[model samples]
Target: MFRALGAVLAAGLILAAAQVPATADTRAPARFSEFSVTPTSLDVDHPTATYTGRLVFTGADGTDQGVPGARVCLDKDGRCVATTETDADGRFSSPVTLSSTGAQPQLRDGEAEAFFNGDAERQSTFVGSGIALHVTQVQARITMGFDHTPSVVGDPVEVSGLLERQTPDGGWIGVVGQTVRVFVDGTRIAEGTTAADGTYRISTRVPVSDEGFWGVETPLPGRGYPYTVAFANTWQRAAHRTLVTGFNAAPEPVRKGAKLTATGRVMRVTADGSTEPATDYPVLQFSADGKKWTDLYEDHPNSQGYFSLSTPAERDGYWRVRTEDWPDLPSTSSVDYVDVGYRTAISGFNASPEPIAKGRRLTVAGTLKRDTTAWKAFSGQSVKIYFAAKGATSWTYEGTAKTSSTGHFSHTFTAAKDGTWRAIYAGSTTYVTVTGPGDYVDVR
Candidate 1:
């Protein structure tokens, strides 16, 4: 019996030693070297933009670690900007400012990388892997037409709109109590705050300009509230409570072969004797037949909001002139068409270098093929050129010249600088239509 008991004890001791808790050799310290952010791209169209709401970092072993920091720096083209960091729960938050000119505030194309000293005891850098953010600023619409040319300066001009806010659903959330800042030629002029109804009223002195219209910028403060920039002149009036307005300022008609240049001032008529210039608006020139037209000039509104555009030679037919409203003024025409002449079909012709490079001589040259070869020449057809730029949607006339007796027409357009450009040719009484969307070219 004693020998059997001793054998059982020896077997139990051997089993216990085999199980020995797998030994200290099986345990090791963790090491990592890689990190990333989520979503991969940041879009800046809304003032209140957010990432997937998190920063995700990765390690050399493909393991994830949360980044901890209240602030992160991002550089664009050379300008560096900072964003706030996450909270203790591994979340960071920050307000994005969209009004910095040096930073390329339009968030659509801006980007940055996030980094932090994470787990200092391990000497590891917590960096997010492959994260993207889409951010944007809220847009503001100013009341009145493109050119405000009010007949008087210092009169109370009512400006109203919703302070747009952005929501997490990648959409806009309209809010009230936003501040509207007024600026003229890059200078602050006045400010007003929006009410609960998302509207603002401001009384300000008009900036000095040859034309009454002034460049106006309204910046709303908050996360993702984009700065709004616009122009207003005194020549046109708001038709009703809605933002729509009509250009009451008419062009002084000119006749063909006449030496008289079309010259005039644009003003907005008000109940009071006050007047504002239409400089912020562009001056348009229409052909006598009213079918073909050209833009002549864009002038800055004078302190009194006044502007004038002159044609060097006498105009041949009926011409109309006006500024373009934001959101585009309702026009009877579709697809930006113009009639050139009789018996020739010139369709799908696109123009290039909109606003026709300023000071640089531009050749308004494009392929001109008539459906019917029987129509040999587009002779003496009046080819008119129009110009505009980023700030100016309204077209201005650079110059107009007639085509030679041959079927081909070319005009030397000399502008003061580079801008968007388009051209139209008036052939006989019929207008020629361009074939496709106008082309854009950079001369500089």
Candidate 2:
């Protein structure tokens, strides 16, 4: 009885094994029929593109195995331009190389069909099986990136996209928060993950040296190669690189009474490197008092990180230049200053407590004037007052008063019921901050 039971069990095992499906293999049994390609569609960059396509074979009782070592090809009429072989995993992949300059390949444009042939020993003509795959050109667009900028190798970076991708199966896929690999001039910079809303914020930081500018490249995974986004500028980097040369950090005390210049590279900084200089926002501004600014020259960055600005030297005062920061792109030197001449200039001066009252007002005063032969004239200029209580973001405009023809103005603010008081003395639109006594003023 035990022997009979063992025999029955062994027979049952054999039956199950026989019923098992035959994966794509060179020695698959006959009667193997039916082949389906997953994704059923493909998005290739161009004619000379290489992409992996999955082909699945289904046989009777799943016993039908895949035909490994089978050749697949694409042809126009009779000439075969590309050929691919099935892998052990039943995947057939080939570089769909074509001439972009000449005749372009299109869907249903030419007789492009996949074929599979069984081994010579097999009585059937067809190999495991062949399925038709539709090909389409991938839709790509230029997308700008924003900085939640991450520089550290493991820091999270915030990246968002403005372009959308269409899947092969007629489905619209948004690429806003798509995670992509960060690369620098063909080298892998780092990997980043996209946010839930199609924006990506990579926290991973990259190792940065004193490179002038690093390139930023992002590759859509399993889709295509990397595309550049922006460039970053650095002073320590030896060689010139791709980057948007906006405003770099300007140094103090440029030169007095001569032409002052400040220039540097600007680019996007990511775990990756800098991007090519495509867009430039060049700026060259000057300030005589270092409080009021004037733009002498301005231009955009070109493909190269070359920027030049020329301004007159200060005679007896200080002057400086400034620029705005770019998104994703780090500025080289945004500002710089210089002082020309044997200057005995008043750098800064401040006074406080407006409205001249203990409980009802707070007052403050200040002046910003160049040390010149006409310094006495500034003393006669009108001055405004601004006030605010503690924890206030903006100062309240109180009133304007003229100096006693001596560039000096004062006012006492009537406080309602003061706890803490602060004042600002406006100097030609510029204001100085000053705080009053914190002692509580008696309202009674």
Candidate 3:
């Protein structure tokens, strides 16, 4: 029984010894014979770079030999971003896509490392520092348009444009949801965000400046990326804030063939909200229908910024003053309307029956004529007849009469005492008012 227990114990010990694993061979130091990363710069246009290297070790015969079937990886920030295996020549090629958050690549220290883990016979090694890596921002461009190219101070200006970025294939694509800023004479005035289609719009008032120049810019979208500066095109002329103010045209009911005057002031608004006289010349224009205008006169404003222009009153029309079409300053004033009427006169005025009995009927008559190129009868006009007692200081309102188509007007009044009579035609928008010569009548 003792021999049987001892045999079983020996068998257990032999089985346990047999189950033990064999010791591994010592690892040999290995290195990358030729390791390089192609196109060290990465950008939105070219987001992928190539990593290539060869793994080698000293063989038992003291000669360098390839370590085949070994795994290689490209690491960034200690994390593998790409991996591949060595071929029969111990050469490996791997594509490294930058780790990105949104459209921005994650980069630190602007460097990368290519590494290999150890195997039973080869020790681990990596490409050391001094390998240059850069995260470059994509190339960008902008196109812009102004709602009012020559804008006035205190008025809003709208700017719109598109933002585009270059692609790897040398093509352009719109950049979405990016902030765009507007600058007037190097000062940022307004900002807006790009839409889904890369279009952006901003509205801001024209800032006061002695010399105005407008421009636009868009910074690179992501952090830790290098930028290439670019700006949109700007307007050609220096900005100006000039306007015509307090415009007037008179007389309100001017007669034909008479002088009509237009007056206004041309002022320049400054950055501090103060105004000064502008030396620019102003033009007086006339419009028959208020839609199309014709230049009537041009003259420079005085030191006080006031200008007066005169032209013969012709037909009814609108009048306005505007600054000359200067390269820097262009402005217009509010319009004024004028009513022009023909010159009118009373002719052949008389009161019949110079000597008459008491209570006799007295008749007063006259012809109303309007002058254009020539005199013509003006019809459908209201005329009044007045009477004054012979030594009376004031005339009495006797009666009213309308001129006929022949321009003739007459009225009858019963004369009870010695008096002087006259006919008067009141003026209208188309004809001038006139009073006829007085005729005296005596009651018998």
Candidate 4:
């Protein structure tokens, strides 16, 4: 009876053992043979980078073998940010885009890792012991230009430009609502905020500088981006400034062949808005049509910034003063228009028959001459005959006479009463009006 019972028990145990499933894995353990993240440094603009490595397992024969179709992942701060499956050769490549929140705290002080979760056939492991990465803020650049070239002193200068940040693909995008500052000769003068389009405009009256070096920049500090980098090649330029006032050309209706004087003040505007006499010279220029100009003369200003230039009047034109092109100062004054008329005279006047009967024919004659290099006959001119009663304040107009080729004019009129007779020549655009000497004519 005992032998029979043992046999049944052994059979039952064998049956139970056969029904139970196997729990042990027959595949080799898996691990990363090699793993690394390209371009250890990262930034907000270029937040994405690549991570590549190979997943391998120890083979049954004790040689490492490729673990094909295995999964691998990139871990950052204990979180899986990117994942990829190994190819036929156990190699895997995946892109990792860092989040702003993830990158902010790690700016200049963070690292990334590669991890793998164990599968049914392999044990879990990671290969990021020596691999390291860095997260950094994006690079910024400023491009700008002055609204007006060659700015004037004591006047506002407007500077405008776009602000941009570098991208991961080497492209650029505008940085909106950022503050930008302007500097003149290394001194901060103005600042403004960017618009939605990344454009900004700043206007300010910069102090005077001999070199006149101007530039713009964006400083990154205490603005939530401490690691942000600003390019050294910010927008820079060299410019000049000048101030000229109180310009005048005297003798508005200047007579031809007479001396005409031009006066003005040339000053330098200091940083404090004070004016002082500039040591530069002033050039006197004349323009016939106000479009083209000719340099007439130049002179230095006195201690009080006053200067005077004299020249002979020649024709109707415009005049202006231009500050000499000095390395430190340059400027131009407002234009002044001058009217110059030619000098004219009347000679050889005669009125015949003094103390005669009334209603007699009277003759008036005169020679009209224009003064140029020398006095010459003025032809094709009209002359009027005038008469004034004895001791009268004004003269009475009679008739007109045309001048001959020799500039001699004669007019005959019927006299009525005793009066003084004279010939007058009206002025033209190029000549001045003149009256001939009066001759007494009597009519009874």
Each candidate structure's TM-score, on Cα atoms with residue i matched to residue i, is 0.27, 0.26, 0.41, 0.39
Shift in Å, residue 104, candidate 2: 24
| Top of the candidates by lDDT | 3
Per-residue lDDT tens digits for candidate 2, residues 1-444, read: 999999999999999999999875555334324333344344443334443443345556864455566565544334466677777755665656543111122322233345445455332233333344444545544243536433443234444344345555665544443345544334554545444433444333334444423343234322222211222222222222224334432323423344556666545433345454434465565555666666667766556646655665554343333335433332334344443532222212333333234454445444324344344324554455554555556666667656554455565656564333323322221221222222223333
Q: By TM-score, highest first, what's the ranking?
A: 3, 4, 1, 2
Error of 4 at 231 (Å): 7.2
Q: Please, what are the lDDT tens digits per residue for candidate 4 over residues 1-444?
A: 999999999999999999999897665577888888777776665667688888888776988788888878787656677788989988988887765431123323355677778787778788748456665667678787777763455566688888887777888878776777777777778888778777889887755656667777775542335236342223333323556788889887677878889998887766557777776788889999999999988987888878999988888899998886554367889999988887778899888766667777777888888887788898898999899987789988998988888989898878788889888877877776777888887677
The TM-score that candidate 3 achieves is 0.41
Query: Which 10-residue window of candidate 2 scores lowest in summed lDDT?
Result: 100-109
Candidate 3 lDDT at 210 equals 55
1-444 per-residue lDDT for model 3 (tens digits): 999999999999999999998896578888888888788877755667788888888887987688899988777766687788999878988887774322223442266677888887778998775366777665778888888764566566789999877777788777676678888878888888778777889988777655567888875454456334446957534445788988999987788879999888898876446788887788889999999999989987899989998989888899998786543367889999888887788889888877988888878888888887799987888888899998999999899888899999888878788888887877877776677888888877
Q: What overall lDDT goes with each candidate model?
A: 0.44, 0.44, 0.78, 0.76
Which lDDT value does model 3 have at 40?
82
Residue 343 miss distance in model 3 (angstroms): 8.5
The 10-residue segment of model 3 with minimum total lDDT is 100-109
Q: Name the lDDT of candidate 3.
A: 0.78
lDDT of 1 by residue, 308-380 (tens): 4445333334444555543223222111112223234333344444544446666665434333335455565
Q: Which candidate number would show the highest TM-score if scored against the true structure? A: 3
